[model samples]
Target: MDVSKVRKDFHILEKRVRGKPIIYFDSACMALKPKQVIDAVNSYYNDFTACHGRSVHYFSAQTTEKYIEAHRKVERFIGAKENEVVFTKNCTEAINLVANGLKWEKGDRVITTKMEHNSNLIPWMKLAKERGVVHDYVEVDNEGKLDIEDLNAKLETKTKLVSLVYTSNVTGATLNASEVAKICHDAGAMLLLDGAQAVPHMKVDVKKTGVDFLAFSGHKMLGPSGTGALYGRLDLLKGMNQFIVGGETVKNTMLSSWEAEDSPAKFEAGLQDYAGMLGFGAAADYLMRLGMEEVHSYEKKLARKLYDGLKAIPQVTNIYGPSNPEERSALASFTLKGMNPQEVALILDESANIFVRSGMHCCHLYHQDVIHEMHGTIRPSLYIYNTDEELDKFFDALRNIAALA
Candidate 1:
């Protein structure tokens, strides 16, 4: 991939913040949207300002056509059919849909990993509380590497689903999707992947992997916020009940009985974010044009440099996850020997205009239980728009920050 050209697409990279250009290293939290996504969102408000479907007005027709195409585009982007993809408010909601929608009995069990974001972790816990279902975990090491043998041991006849992150947002460690899928399937359990961190940074083909469901957010992939998707196997989706019920979710209703719409429509309730959906499609298109394999390779090369630089800093105490960049996404979470993570983050921003994430990174279990760092670690995450020069500046700024340590 042309990294320079990719940086050009993100106009925010061109603008200065507080008298200095931004070296954004927080793509894991939310990716910087490109101009193409921005323009697509703008076109919705500027051109078509009408609701989709059940209307024959010109703008309404335009909205309907665009909405359908958006669905198809995202479906193609994820290697799923148009009918198999359901749009939700975010990945959290998408995960909740599967958690609640799937037919569950009192004794049923759900499995997830210790390294999950709260989005993937909580729903199963709630199910265990409210529905008398069993919720279990596939343990990970201190460095956030999942134990595959423990996963195989956890499966049982009662296990209904195995939900796990395809890639760790905090540590950047990746779960083996295909192997996990086979293990879960062999044990008669459906595998659900929290792909919020994986789908954006790498290629995730659902059919080839045989994962039953995947949930990911558009905002993490340069699409608009408040837009996310759940890709489910068609038969499985057809079997699920609607997670939410509202106007667009039903086909017809009666005083005594109601008929629900098909798979996606049945699951999507109320008015949808038509503009955000279009912008999401556009973002997928942008990534497709750039190529995901190329994106992965570029991030790997940059991450290796980042890993080496951080390792060279004498004040740096820990680098979370594996040392090999190719084994994980382009992210690093580390702690300074004598400095708080928040203090390090503040220094990086004030001194060099760098943006990084600090705190538990939404994985308190990993921090409090595994790494034993309650203050959390400073994380510098990268994307296609990030450059080697940015890494050089990051190292320079970090070295200066280390003097205080």
Candidate 2:
């Protein structure tokens, strides 16, 4: 990939702070948007601003067409049918849709990993509290990789679902989805992958992985916020209960009764974010044109460089995840020996115009129980738009920071 050309696509890269060019290393939180996505969002508001699938006016018709097309684009991106894609506000809502909508019997078991984000973990915990559902967490190794043996040991005949993160937001460790899916299916359970970190960095084929359900956010993939999707098997979705009721989710309603719409529409209640959907579709198109394999290869190369550079620093300690680039995404979470994570992040921003995440990254269980880091680690996440020069600048800043340590 042409690094300089890719940087040009994101206008945010031109931004300056503290008399220096901004070095954004927080893509895991939210990616920087490209001009193409921005234009697509603007076109929706400028050319066609009307409610979708509710009226017969020209604006409504055009808006609905774009909205439906966006669904198809996302479907193609994730290897799912158009009807299988249900738009949600974000990944959190997508996960909740499955957690709440699924028919959970008393004492039914759900398996998850210890390293999952709060969005993935809290819903199941809530279910266990409200209903008689059983929630179990698989163990993670020191490197933050999920223990397959522990996962298998946790699985039982009563296991209803095995929901896990495709990639760790805290450690950037990528999971073997196909292997996990096979384990779940062999144990007579369904697999649901939280793909918020994986989908943006690598190619994810639901069919190949044989996942029963998948959830991801568009904002982390160069799209607008308040846009995400859930992909569920058609048969499962048809049988599952509706999450939110009212409005476009239903086809017809009487005083005493109501009939819900088909699969995708049944899950999507009320007015949708038409502009955000268009921008998400455009973002998917942009990534497809570049090719996911190429994107993955480029990111791995950058990640390797980042890991090697950080390891060479004497003050840097306890770099999380696998050392191998192919086993992880383009991110490195670590800590300086004596400095607080938040303090280091603030210094980087104020002195070097660098933006990095510092905290537990919402995986409180992993931080509190697994790693036992009370403060947290400094996380520098990368994307296609990030360049080597930016990494060099980061290394320079780190070396100076190390002197203090």
Compared with the true structure, all predictions reach lDDT values of: 0.90, 0.92
> Per-residue error at 310 for model 1, in Å?
0.8
In candidate 2, the residue pairs with backbone N, CA or C atoms under 3 Å apart (3 or more residues apart, or in different chains) clash, namely none
lDDT of 2 by residue, 1-405 (tens): 887998999988887776668999999999999999999999998998999988999999999999999999999999997699999989999999999999999999999988999999999999999998999988888888889999989999999999999899988988899999998899999999999999998898988889999999999999998899999999999999999998998989999989999989999999989999999999999999888899999999899889989999999998999867668778988989999999999999988989999999998898888888889989999999988888999999999987977
TM-score against native, each model: 0.98, 0.99
Ten-residue stretch with the least lDDT total in model 2? 11-20
User: Please, what are the lDDT tens digits per residue for candidate 1 over residues 142-162?
Assistant: 668889888889899999999
* Residue ranges of candidate 2 with Cα displaced over 4 Å: none
Model 1 residue 334 CA deviation (Å) reads: 0.8
Q: Candidate 2: RMSD over Cα atoms?
A: 0.8
- Backbone clash count, each prediction separately: 0, 0
